[model samples]
Target: MAYLIGILITIIILLLGYIGVIEMQIRSMSEQLERRLKAHTRQNISVQLVSKNLNQLVICINKCLKAEENLRLKSMQEEKQFKEMIANISHDLRTPLTAIQGYQQLLEKGELSEEQRKRLAVARKHSEELKGLIDHFFEYAYLLNTQPEIKLKRINLTGLVTDCLIASITSFEEANKPLEFEETAPVYVEADEEMVTRIVQNLIRNSVEHSEGTIKVEVLSNKEGILRFINPVREPEKIDIQRLFERFYSGDEARSRMGGLGLSIVKLLAEQMKGNVTAEIKGDLLEIKVTLPLAQ
Candidate 1:
């Protein structure tokens, strides 16, 4: 009976070994299949990502091409408008100038008596006025397109303003308008002196042109550490204050003949020197203010 029990135990141990071998083979095959499926999924995901990026790049390129085409069309339209303007300017000026030249020649030839020559002189004066207007147009247009090269340095505002107003005093002498200089203490600023002078000149001219009778100039400092010069306008219009900075805004049709770019040039120069110019129309006074950075 003992011999029979030993043989049965050996048979059971052999069966267990065979079962373990079959289980290990099944696990190996399952691992290999999983790895192949993972690689296939990863490759598909990479290809999809590449395709999406390609679509986005294609859209960006299309937008850039369309923008280039639109800009070209706009440039052509502006060129056409400029040519038409030049033609119109020539016609407006040539007609009056030609008439004046013909009348002057008749007077010079002694074809007209003294009294008739005096009448022709009136025509000549009107023609000269028209010619001056045309010349002003050319100058203002040139200034608009070409910039004056700036040489920057410290500019003394106290002396500059005093001198400018003194030079312009005779211009307003008839009106008995006195220039009220508020502050005379030397206020120095760091900027192009020539440009600043031009700015001040234009401001003074505008004040004398538009201001009632009295022109007051101030170089005052506020809590914000900004220095400004203020001028009053003579006649305030119903037009918006912002419109004064625009080109070709005339204060009066009879008094003003130029394209009204005096203030506009002042505005352009002020901006170039890291300054800002603005205007306000009170009930009757038009106030212009220019703010410039103070030199440390």
Candidate 2:
């Protein structure tokens, strides 16, 4: 009876020791998982214990890690390829576009009949539109490929927007659309000057192209400087407010040609300067708003 009792005691001690080992192994695995997640490392989980269940768990975890790494690498490769493709296409189109513009300028300088002159003017207009489209494409591709170096400074938002609107007066006249801008007090913001100018220009151009009636501009201030553009759209139902800022997104086929890249560029530039843009439809009107941080 004494020998049997001794054997039982020994067996209990061995079982306790095995359980302790397993607990330690589990703790080590947990720590390893945490470190791997924080560091984004490619290391696989490993177990020191010689238990079949623990080994199987480790195997499953390692497989999952390997799969995740593969997916990440694949996504990176695809993105690189897409950027390269855009860059190449933009570069290729630029040469021919430049040549076309040069020829158009030469034709303008030559003497011709009134009918010929009118036809040349039409051709010139179309060519200019094409050039603008190509320029937007190139700019969009460049923005995607490189991180922009933003020069942020305290700028008068009211003055800047006013200048942009004045410059766009000719465009509005050409489009046979009226523009209304109510002057407000000087609103100051901390933003990149060039980017802000681009944003305003793009917004104005979008309105000129899409607005059915008078285009309205307003500047307001709360905690941030807000620039608002309100325009009556022809078919409000066609415009998807949610996808307005998406690259190459357009509400209709006609808009698809002229509206490509403009809003997307505005969105990207605004985000780079720590600003935001939003669009909504109210009745027959489409209102777009841009908000920037106020200068201290």
Number of clashing pairs per prediction, in order = 3, 0
Model 2, span 1-296: residue lDDT tens: 99999999999999999999899999999999999989988888999888888899999989988998899999999988987887888899889888987987898889888999999889888887877787788888898899989999999999999998888888999999999998889999999999999999988988888889999999999999999999999889988899989988888665688746888988999888999999999999999999999999
Error of 1 at 67 (Å): 4.7
- With a 3 Å backbone cut-off (N, CA, C), the pairs that clash in candidate 2 are none
lDDT: worst 10-residue window of model 1 = 41-50
Point to the candidate with the largest TM-score: 2
Tell me the lDDT of candidate 1: 0.65
Score each candidate by Cα lDDT. Answer: 0.65, 0.90
Model 1 TM-score is: 0.60
Cα error, residue 30 of model 2, in Å, equals 6.9
Q: CA shift at 27, candidate 2, in angstroms?
A: 8.3
TM per candidate comes to: 0.60, 0.81
Per-residue lDDT of candidate 1, residues 175-278 (tens digit): 56667776556777767887777788877766665666567787754421133434444445644576778766876653356557677777888888888888
